[model samples]
Target: MAADPPPPAEIPPAGPSSAATARAGTTPVHRLLPVIVPALAVGVASALVLLGISLLAEKLQDVLWGTVPDALSIGRHSSLWTIVVLTACGLVVGLLVRMVRGHADPDPATTGLVDPPLAPGVVPGLLLVTVLTLAGGISLGPENPITAANIALTCWLGRRFAPGTTAELWISLAAAGTIGALFGTPVAAALILSETLASHPGPGALWDRLFGPLAAGTAGALTMTLLAHPSFDLSLPPYTHPHWGDLLSSVVIALAGAVLGLTAVYAFPYAHRFFRALKHPVPALALGGLLLGLLGALGGHLTLFKGLDEVRVLAADPSGWSAGQFAVMAVVKTAALLIAATCGFRGGRIFPAVFVGVALGLCAHALFPSVPVALAVTCAVLGVLLAITRQGWLSLFTAAVLVGGAAVLPILCIASLPVWLLVTGRPQMQLHEDGTPLR
Candidate 1:
């Protein structure tokens, strides 16, 4: 199913609305009413926004794909076209950032863990720009914007009504719930939120904290279902059941994935810094696009865009490509992604990373002729991003979920084990407090 469109207007949470916060005399239950009502409001509003965004995205995609083949035919094969579109996208991003000046691009890593919430209006801008970039093939995904908008929308509503908990916690719950609904797995999103929150110090005990997100997740999931969001039934093909030996192979694959993940984390920050140092967003974006174009030239069109459609297409028909081409695709995609991240474009890194890993897994299966291609892709995706995101347990489960194969469960577990070992030690996510850099 196609993804729902993002929120329409960027609505930042109106600042503290007179920091008095829920009149000191209100009863506990009475106070609770504010949060509860707002939470529900957020769910409904966000769903509507997402639906609109999805429709817009579909229409936009039609225009883009229609023009793309013609552009390619006219010697626009080099990533120059991607760069041109992305540069224009960067300008749009810049214009919005300048206009609303909301949380720049609604960074994904910050959302899942409950970082301080942005003003309410932030969601719509993010939704609009992300839709524009993604639909235009700017090498990013909608997931970040989706999750960010959900969090922002909820927090905005919460602040308007509740004004009790720290805006930060509400923001976290908003993020958790949004992710939960989007993925159609509230448990996983809640776990991810809990684990992420645990990584840092905050008000409220684990149980107290879990209450909001659990409710939010339940609500979010309901919203997804009622709206018939495509993610409502996220499932991959079932692979052959895992054998004991497959577990051993998983360990090997996990280790490899972890290494890549860690490297990505370490490298991304530096790449981002390098481009920012260049100071000119246009030149930096153009340069990033040029590198992406070179990668596309080598990897074929598969490396182009955000790669979500490609992932779906590949999963549906894994037999379409030979191993060598898959391997090359993985390499080129990695380069393209690194370039995109380093550039000024704002979007999520996870999906693109998964795309690269999946292609690589397909290539590896071809070469080894032993491991199931699907299994290898699943393991690599979970293992690598777990390290990169610094969420081992979440990564492990996410990997298993991505594969959607009960038979491959053992293999997924095995792969995650070694990856876990390699990825030992909690890595801190870069977050901001009061909109200022924390690290």
Candidate 2:
């Protein structure tokens, strides 16, 4: 849930933190304490900040849906209301960014599970617009912007209160904390950070390096759990035994998902170009909203919004949807994600991507009822995330965590190898140009 500005903020953990890192010859204890002492503090701060923004947005969304749509006498899920409401959201967001100073619009490309920290001053505008984005069913999530905001906030807090802590340390912790808050598990943050930490050179052991962020993630996850808990468990049937057929089918279905996701990756640049072609936020966003409304009309309300809840709905009763309907839902959701991101909407892509992948998985399962539904969904998620983000472990985590069972792990591991080879060198979904560039 980001989209703050141009040139994408470089996430702090891209490497080691200069500010709070261990000295070249320091003892292990020195590194450990430095991180441990401030771990809880950063995590709590991240949770509190995220909790406040989330509560504010949820209440605002309730009002928008409960009163505004009803008061307008337009059906909440009706085509007309979807069109008018989304178009209005675009207009208001565009005008705010245009007319207001510090409205905080970053490069939409980098607003996702990972993004560089933003300044605290930008927090207010971002919070304001992100709330509006969520309320208006903009096909985005709150992860990116909130993560960025927390990074900036933690950085500032570290410098002010804990003068000894490095900005990078705080940035990483804040990011970890936000991930915990978003996914309701510290594991999500830890898994995503594995690649980052593996490449880093430091004085401590790898686990030692991870200590602070993990601690922070645990705290943040707990805070979110107690306040507004979220779970990826879709209540699907447990896979008891691994069949030989499941392995082959998993590969096939997952590869199909990868192919599907690559379509969006290839289309992403073109979509961003088309929206920015207008060279004006007002018309661009308004038109994007209109297109999304058309999609919503076709796919229904289940396809709208960030998709966390919608994914559950699809999973709870996969057999209810015909194969064609599942296909429509996946395609429409992906298109909406592209439009919302390329246009001026503020949010992240991971949550929506997960939802789209689930739809694709469901479609595959429906097409071939012989394949285990959980297996298809798991592998499909792995494939799509691999193409979209090009991060293998994170993709593995999404697939593994969503199924909520260890029985699928061995098959997923084998499936990931071919999928990894297919997506190893693909270009990421990030845009290189914010404005018009040579096509």
Candidate 3:
């Protein structure tokens, strides 16, 4: 009874101060620890993973289509063959995902547009799948995989730094920065992140999220400059400058762009549903491939893939293309993208979207005969991008840089404003059943 009474003298609960004292007593103090631990670990891990995946994509591209007798032969392929290839790829992808759960076999329509950022553990597969899809004539681009990998890497690193505090936010910023670096415009990346990040929050939460974006973007830019990766291009034309006429024309062009952009938005979801209705990835994919082939049949091989070579060629030498050819290319390329995107092929709509804008812009320039080719192309590119992305500054920068001149910046920026307004006001796409924004 006496011992029980003594034990009843309650031990006071440990307070925060006591806990801190205990922690301080045991915590190791190594001055080199902080610097050595996070920087070395995150940096090296990110670099190795990114580089490995990048090399994998390159090698896979070579394995699939590098041995072509000629790049032009890409267009000469038959629609049936394209369909067959697409179906086979879809079959493989579906089979692969069959056993996996929680995003193992991503649906194409849901993959880039609707899905959240991928985890690092799944990035390699995402990269591999995309590379194969693109190489095999899927109407997609590298941007999806690039963005996926970037966010995945950041999430992986962030989790290591702090168990789970704001990991998704960090991942989002990393995604923006990576895209910005890839596109060679940090400002655009910031704008895209801002627009994409905006949500109806409780009062001050918006500002809270911005911090990670800024830091991530800064880090990404540093990485781009230091690494001297392919995305470091900042080329612009010195001689070019915007004329008053360019501004006026851009306004008109933006209206046209709004129509087309909205059309794409509307068509995209329906196309996705059409493919998904098939309920079988293989046949759906094959049908998409056949459609792609048929589309390419009209434009030749240049219309295949995500249209990078076409963009490159046009950027380098616009004279190689005629008005008719550009129009055909635009239609075919758009169709191919719609099919590939809606089907189970893993890829991005961004590049193909840009290409379509460029084509439309060039076509408008040709048909009108009043707008300068450069001005029209620049305006069209910005308009379409703005329509698709609903991002202001990013679209402005993209319009300027991709066209290679600051002169068009004024026109591009001015024109993009209205287009942004209109497109942004339109109904948000039903990218997911729950009405959430696609990644």
Candidate 4:
């Protein structure tokens, strides 16, 4: 469905009495009450949907990676199994995209976190493919497809029941809810929405405009917290104090990560073009799967799937691998993310990018033992996310959340400035239908 048009730059002026009443807080409170109720409903529903799909994917992942591999009496992490499963996944997702209604709502390569609401019929197929991508060891995160699915479902339902609400409101509530559920916190939702809403001129105070989304985000975050108990912290060694040298190291490491991330961003359009040239989803995805399989084999199972769990494993023993090994894993995972995204597999880039950043940071620390692990990891994550996601608040939040440290924030904020300058006007990782970069 086409997106709702933006609200006019200037709303029709309110009458003097209504304006006076709004200033007295009577009008705004009544206006917000209606939105708050529906926003809460949307938030709970969004969390339920996200949790349902995630649980299903986990079960499927167990069967694919656990049951079948054990039944075959082969190591689950064996190179041969990695190649076979990934290639097969590509073929399966390719067939689904070819046959499913709405073709799973455009090439995922062309979409972002919050896009135009899709027809309700498209949600099921998108969710199914998303599950397959997650379960099939594809190196992508659930964020994009799940967010899109929630937004589409909420918008369709809201239009029917809450006809008084605008589609944009439903979209915001759903997006915020899903983000809250994903991150296990409403703060992430608030940070992201603040950046997004700041760009569009709207009436009322920012807090007033944020009321519904915050309600939804809180509900979603609480629901997910009660049910799943997810955590982003890596439990790395504490970064208690910042030193003069720490700031220098953080900047250097952050810049290094930005360079690596920008390399993938620059390569994204060409990769999409290469896959599109195949002229069919089947061939494109099949080839993509095969390549990813090869990458998985080279990078090992540590590099497969979304990087969330794998990142923890890496962090548990940063010294287990040498700097060279970390470099190889970082490069391989970045390539895998690029291929998975471009080859029509459904997923987000952020999780895998985090893994890359962590790997890069570890590599830095491995080479220079003087740098603190927490500081290294957070700065690298901040730099990579700044370049890749192009959202300053999200980059800083994710980086800080990963380490669970307030001490690193000061350095990260400083380090991000140069990285942001580096990526600001560059082409994004996303693409237009014509295969041009979304600059």
Candidate 5:
């Protein structure tokens, strides 16, 4: 009104100082406090949910593999029973997928460790199929579905209560929580998330970005450890001395494992296309189960399911089997993993991949007898995981964890270099809906 109001004092956009002040306002404690509580809740919830589903699956597995067979006076894990149960499982899963909402999630082949939050309506069917897969001795694991379910639940609830928080935060917290529970360690969550979260743009240090996830991981890990008492160490003879020969053997075995895993990777898209050609879940999954049953019969019971216990069994008596037996087991497991993954099974490949690595490593040890068992196993595991998962840190961590020693670490680090080169830029095991490699 009066003299144009002095043209209004010109206000400047936020400069470096203002931005710094804004950043300062969100101090580590201040930023962490808001999400930490929710993160802890998510972590505990994720662990409990994982444990519940696992326990349920175990009970079902006991009935299917033990009680039913025992009552019927049939040999447990016999070939006939294996075929019957697997085929029945396929029919059940197929019926569920055909009848249930969300169809138990898109073909498992198209999913990965971390995916966008699924609809709440989809979670129950996903969980049911996951349970059936686990109990039915499917060659996959519970990681993908459990993680997906937790993420869905977390995001669904978080958005209702804390509308301001980003969906990414919920995803990180849920994934970290589930991974911690699954691996029984927050360190695994940190390692896995470091690879996934590195490129995410944010206004904080790496640790700052990891704060909520680490908290969730810690809670989930503690919950799982206290409840389940899981252990990854195989109690293999420790490797105390590092020699030139061991290094040479490690590199050689690791490269061989990489090549074997690459063969599967190359075959994955074709296998998926072959299954998808059927164009219906029922026949595709039923036929897949029949094939898995045949594989279980051929590989004995060791090649069935997600393979954690089978791996321990193999590790318990690495020398009990002939090199030929080990070779057959490794090859059968690789094929089983390929079939389970491509043919509409709802599980993870990592556990079965671990089994493959252990079998391959033992095969190497059985053949040579001079190489250290720990070194062979670690290197083989590193190579296989590197080729299949394409995760360097995880490959190294899993390899080191299985052996439970620092002595093999340097060798594994060195061995991974060449193996990494072999697998770099290769097509991943995952595929698109159109059956193209996900890469």
Candidate 6:
């Protein structure tokens, strides 16, 4: 009743208050505390989860390659073992998908790394199947499953622990961390996210938006490097001297690789449709395993796994492989990748694709001895990645990272121009709705 009851005082929106404070150049230190706390928490949490998943996979890999072969009294690299292990892996995954709740993770052939977060309850099955797939020498990478698991775990933890952290923000940090750990560098995360993060409207500068993810990525990458995990760099001869001729050669080699990759891309959906034609998961996957076994028998143990180590070993001594041998390895690797992706295996194709590219590049170099090995490899990687991922910056970054040669950076950047032109508007290595391609 005092002065007809003054209207209740309205509280200003927190967003406006923060914006006005920032504009006035007088934002309090506490105003930034929320961001800093969540960023650090996400960083630490990302490192821990990534570390656990990677180590579990690594130990399983040891058993698959070491203990199992020893128990079977066969060399770990024996062709028979490769065939048996891969075929068994396919059946195991099929059985789990048929029996498990949520059918484990979604089909990786139809999914990408940045898909929606996975259901928390489904992670254990996904992890188990992923380990089996990797240990059995499935031509797929841990990127998709690992990234999904990290996102699920991080989002749950953020909601429970950091109420201020938004879901999208947490997901971004999780992906960055997973990528960083996989590539052994925060730079990889930065390059991949550059286009994505810049497209969104956010507070502060673009760098500010990148700050949290970068922190998380750094933490994950550092942990991975400390554990002596495999890296993208193959320690190829450094391109200390960049020649103009190399540019032409990079384009030529890259185009060749792109052609090889596109061949596989075109075949991907057809292969998928063929397997799915079985009309059921078990028989389809089992048959797919049989095909993979045949591939293993042909390609040998070197072509069986995700291909990082195999690619490294191949690149280390280019003189050891003749053009025919390199050609066979590339063909077999690409075929295995296609079969593995289509056959209901829960894995990504990037790692295997890199292997194919390395083989192709080595073949190209062997054919044309005048072409620098590093240039051939970088260009091949760029072209194959463009065909598969359809991401220009990622392809470029990968090419640069593979060589670790500053001289090669400009060459890759320039070579990417033509590669993109060739690959743009083509079908990606993914399935489409209504059985049509994205093209």
Top candidate when judged by lDDT against the true structure: 4
> lDDT of candidate 5 vs native?
0.85
Q: Residue 436: error of model 5 in Å?
A: 0.9
Ten-residue segment with the worst summed lDDT in candidate 1? 6-15
Distance from true location, Cα of 314 in model 5, Å? 0.9
Say which candidate scores most in TM-score: 4
Write down the worst ten-residue block by lDDT for model 3.
4-13
Quote each prediction's TM-score: 0.79, 0.91, 0.77, 0.94, 0.94, 0.89
Per-residue CA lDDT of model 6 for 195-245, tens digit only, reads 565444545556656766777778778877787565677888777888878
Instruction: Report the lDDT tens digits of candidate 5 across residue range 1-439.
Output: 2211111111111111223326645555665666678878889999999999999999999999999999999988999999888888887888898888999887788788887788989999999999999999988889999998998999899888877666677888899899999999999988888886654444556787777888899899999999999888988999988998887899999998999898999999898889889988899889989999999999999999898888899999988999999999999989989988998988888888888999999999999999999998889988898888888888899889998889889999999999988999889888766677755
lDDT of each: 0.60, 0.78, 0.58, 0.88, 0.85, 0.77
Model 1 lDDT tens row, 1-439? 2222222121122122223233566443443444454555555555566567766877886665556657567434445555555455556655655565564554333333334455666766777767766665656656567766666666666666665545554665566566666556667666776666555544335655455556666677677777765441124445777666677766776667666656655566666666667766566666666666566666777777777667776666666788888868776777666666557555666667777767767666767767776677787777667765666666666666666656766666656666766766644323221222222
- Stretches off by above 4 angstroms in model 4 are 1-26
Q: Rank the candidates by TM-score, best first.
A: 4, 5, 2, 6, 1, 3
Q: Which regions of candidate 3 fall more than 4 Å away from where they truly are?
A: 1-54, 68-91, 99-106, 111-121, 197-212, 222-239, 368-370, 428-430, 434-439
| Candidate 6 C-alpha error for residue 308, in Å | 1.0
User: lDDT rank, highest first?
Assistant: 4, 5, 2, 6, 1, 3
Q: On residues 239-350, what C-alpha lDDT tens digit does candidate 2 reach at each position?
A: 7689999989989888988888888877887888887788877788888888888888888888888998899999999999999999899889888988898887878888
Residue-pair clashes per prediction, in order, are: 21, 13, 4, 0, 1, 0
Clashing pairs in 5: 141-348
Candidate 3 per-residue C-alpha lDDT over 283-375 given as tens digits, one digit per residue, 9 for 90 to 100: 776677666656766677667767655676665555567778887887777777767777667777777767777777777876876777667
Question: Ten consecutive residues with minimal summed lDDT in candidate 6?
Answer: 5-14
For all the candidates, what are their Cα RMSDs to the real structure? 6.8, 3.5, 10.5, 3.6, 8.5, 8.2
**lDDT score of model 3?**
0.58
